[model samples]
Every structure is written in C-alpha cells, then in structure tokens.
Target: MASSDHYFYVLQCADNTLYAGYTTDPIRRLAQHNNGTGAKYTRLLKRHPMRMIHLEHFSEKSPAMQAEYAFKQLSKPQKLRYLTEHSSEWLPK
Candidate 1:
C-alpha cells in the first residue's frame, strides 16, 4: 500500500494522558500498546485498553513523524481541541 494510506495516531491513555505514534496498522498497534511493548510512553502509562482518539494520515513517513512530533509539543488544551475537532471520524467506539 502507499505511504499515504498509513497514519500516525494518538490514543487517550487510562490516566487521561495522550500517547502519540505512527503506524499503518492501528489495531495491531493498539494491541502492542496493551501488551507493554509498544511506545515507551505507552509502556510507562501501562493503562491497557487505551482509546483511539485521534489519527492523521500522511503521504510519507517523514511527514507522519513530523506530525507526531508536533502533536507531542502541543499544550493540553490544544491537544484537547484537536481531539474534539477530529473525534467524529478518529475516535474509536
């Protein structure tokens, strides 16, 4: 598949925090997160069963990484606004 089909996503951690990452397989990624061997942030949170709250697609890995970095730098309020605006399609059931 094309890189444009891949996405970087954020999950709302159990502690009400956010975890950012890039993956073409969000479902498998979520499993990895719950399994304690995903991103360091997810491992630290250890709050299994995180909810997929945001996702942004990129035409390439570089841009996806860039977006991930930018997301990480946003303030809590900004992040919340992002989630709010994107939730319609991004948020998991």
Candidate 2:
C-alpha cells in the first residue's frame, strides 16, 4: 500500500502570488512547478520562479487533499497573510 503520509503545499510565484497543492513528494513537486510542468495555473505564472513558501504534512491523503481544496478557495490576500503568520513553519528551508 502507498504510505499514508502526504503533503499539502503552497508556493510563492515570481509575481508574488500563491499556489496551493498536494503531493507525496515535495522536492519533486517543486521541481515540476519550476519547470512549468506542474498545475495549469502555476504554469501560466511560471514567468517568475516558483518558490515553496508553505507546506503541511498529513498522515493521510484525504485530509491533505481536502486542505488543498480549501486552500484553492482562499483569496490571494488571505493566503498571503497566512504565509506571513506561518512563516517559521512554512518558509523554505
């Protein structure tokens, strides 16, 4: 069976915009985002390198997926504020 641990993440695009997603491997996912091979929204904003600014690990895929959905619903400024307050936990290492 696949490992239960998954991650929901957010990236700060070059344009200072946020993109949220879920994945089993954050390192690879970041690569895809940078390479313009990730989500369509991210691809469109790939003019500026996407930098990982937030990530939350989950023990199950369902919860992580749910978070991703909720994150997508957040307004841009709300997401930015979230990142600001959660900087210590989410900022790139």
**Predicted candidate 1 versus true structure: per-residue lDDT over 1-93, tens digit per residue:** 564566879888887777889898788898899888898778874476687877777768888888888888999888777777876755432
Total clashing pairs for each candidate: 0, 0
Clashing pairs in 1: none
What lDDT does the true structure give each of the candidates?
A: 0.79, 0.82
Write down the TM-score for model 2: 0.84
Q: What is candidate 2's CA lDDT for residue 10?
A: 87
Candidate 1 Cα misplacement greater than 4 A, ranges: 1-4, 89-93
**RMSD list, candidates in order:** 3.0, 2.9
The TM-score values for the models, in the order shown, are: 0.80, 0.84
Best by lDDT: 2
